[model samples]
Target: MNPHTISDDKIQAAVALLQAGETVAFPTETVYGLGADASNPLAVQKIFEIKGRPIYHPLIVHIAAASQLSVWAQSIPDDAWRLAAAFWPGPLTLILQRSSQVPNEVTGGQDTVGLRVPDHPVATSLLRAFGGGIAAPSANRFGQVSPTTAQHVHDKLGVMVGMILDGGPCHIGVESTIVSLVHGDAVLLRPGRLSVEAIEDTLNKKILLTQPISTKVRASGMLNSHYAPATPIEIQPADELWIRAHQLANLGYKVAVLNLSDHKKCASSAAITRFQMPLQADDYGRELYASLHRIDHANFDRILAEALPATPEWVAINDRVRRAAQGTTNETRILVRTENR
Candidate 1:
């Protein structure tokens, strides 16, 4: 299919396909989603098949409004309602006990499901017209760079997809912050644009924070190697990264450098591609994924990113960078040179 801008006709067509138990790619503020009728087992199955995503891991259901939450989950906690009011139509997902009406296929046979009302107008329109929750994960093959634009979806899943809603570039450029309330305690399963402090402020109580378990995972994109690029990624201290980058370059490795700022000096012989993120935390968070998307496309032998300050505001971005550097070998420690420090 030709890549075109999103239009009312395209939205209508995509909605129709979803109603017929087929999958379509649509945009949200965070990332493009491969959407299917959450209530339709066959349609949900198609999503897992297309993305090669395992069924044991659940998918997040996108809704048009907070009013639609009860239709998908068994009960909404008071905190969940408060969060919806504060962050709905934004990038926050709530995981709650599923109602019997929610198919096992959508929730990976679990008793809970993740639901969110996206801030994007096109996604909201599609959800409202379809009259049911839509199960949508990022519109990319499983364990690949997520699509932030309509073209990214087309480039990855075109022809394999029934339709693509060209909603332009995603603004948030990351997945939603997933909060699981299924176990009677508010636990943050994944962090996105919504910081833990923001969620705590709305709930009026401290929230439990937990990292994704590598074994027996129940949610999507929880794996360590997820959102990885074809090239290797290394995470190290700011000062010493350039010397290692130069060493890799001398060894015939093409490298890209992502650091906090461009103030650092490196050897002249280094064949390094450098990108400087904003010094401010929120600005850096918003631009994080787009930068990775660009670096992933560059023909680099590896991506070496400098570690950010260990502070509360940088938590979410740190989680993503750490996960991006995770490899099959389960190695998190890259070489750290004392001189660079």
Candidate 2:
């Protein structure tokens, strides 16, 4: 095992590295988070620098306990407590008014901050041992596929991450479901494995899913064109996807196909490769980014994907796929469009 991967066993060392204001990539219930001391603005700044993230983008502060929320954020309402009580140690983040201790840099110069308590034990142990909040975003380059494994972090960032705490793969491979309580109304900022219905059921109220996202309340994953890969990707229905892949292959372009094919469909020829995504949404979500990371490293010149089902369970997956496929222009378009269905 790598030294970085052993952070789960040597948690004290991981805590020590964080206390020294160095960045570490650690696993959470969602994707692996690139963490630094939240209170240390300089350390937090390094996270943005290393990831090539924009200064205006806010970072989520991960805590070990729900009680610690008050330290970073202020004016927590009853709805926040109710949601936290129900979803803490899970894949949900709450945006609230920031405390003076939370620097403007953390909130992208806004008066609010995103806070989460990850459900991974290694992340909890690190927070508890360090005795403070860890400011983290996804542990990959800005606007790229988020990393789910420690190896993904190391492969993408190399030594940019001082250490990586490998807690194996994340259970939920997408980012956390972010909701804003800063306005005293339930507004869904971003979707994740935790569905909107689950959050609404926990709060017993109907929540708004999308909004104009004013400067005062900008949250994570608000950007329209993010989470993309270097490969030019086009998405279509499975039948249409295969037709596109075959056409691209005939044009002398190597292509990769991703669909919900339980059995392998295309043989791996010089110009064509194939992969199967599970039909179930949860299983598909878990494999989404990691699979993308693999496809990204391959020699494929173009990628053709099958669009997921347009159902409530697939909302988060749909949002991510749309964003990831947003900026592929040169390779030709088939059914790639981000406009709402």
lDDT of each: 0.80, 0.85
Report, for all candidates in order, the number of backbone clashes. Answer: 1, 0
Residue-level lDDT for 25 in candidate 2: 89
Show model 1 residue runs off by greater than 4 Å: 1-5, 211-217, 267-270, 328-341
**Leading candidate by TM-score:** 2
**Residue 82, model 2: Cα distance from true site in angstroms:** 0.5
Best model number under lDDT: 2
lDDT score, residue 45, model 2? 92
RMSD (Cα, Å) of candidate 1?
3.7
Residue pairs with backbone overlap in model 2: none
Worst 10 residues of 1 by lDDT: 332-341
Against the true structure, candidate 1 reaches a TM-score of 0.90
lDDT of 1 by residue, 1-341 (tens): 32445566777888889998899898899899999999999999999999999888799999999999898987778888999999998999998889888999998888888999999877888888888889999999888778888777887788989888877778777788988886667888887888899999888888887733431226767787787766678887876778777878888988887777565455334578777778877777667767777776777777888878777767667767767777524443454344322
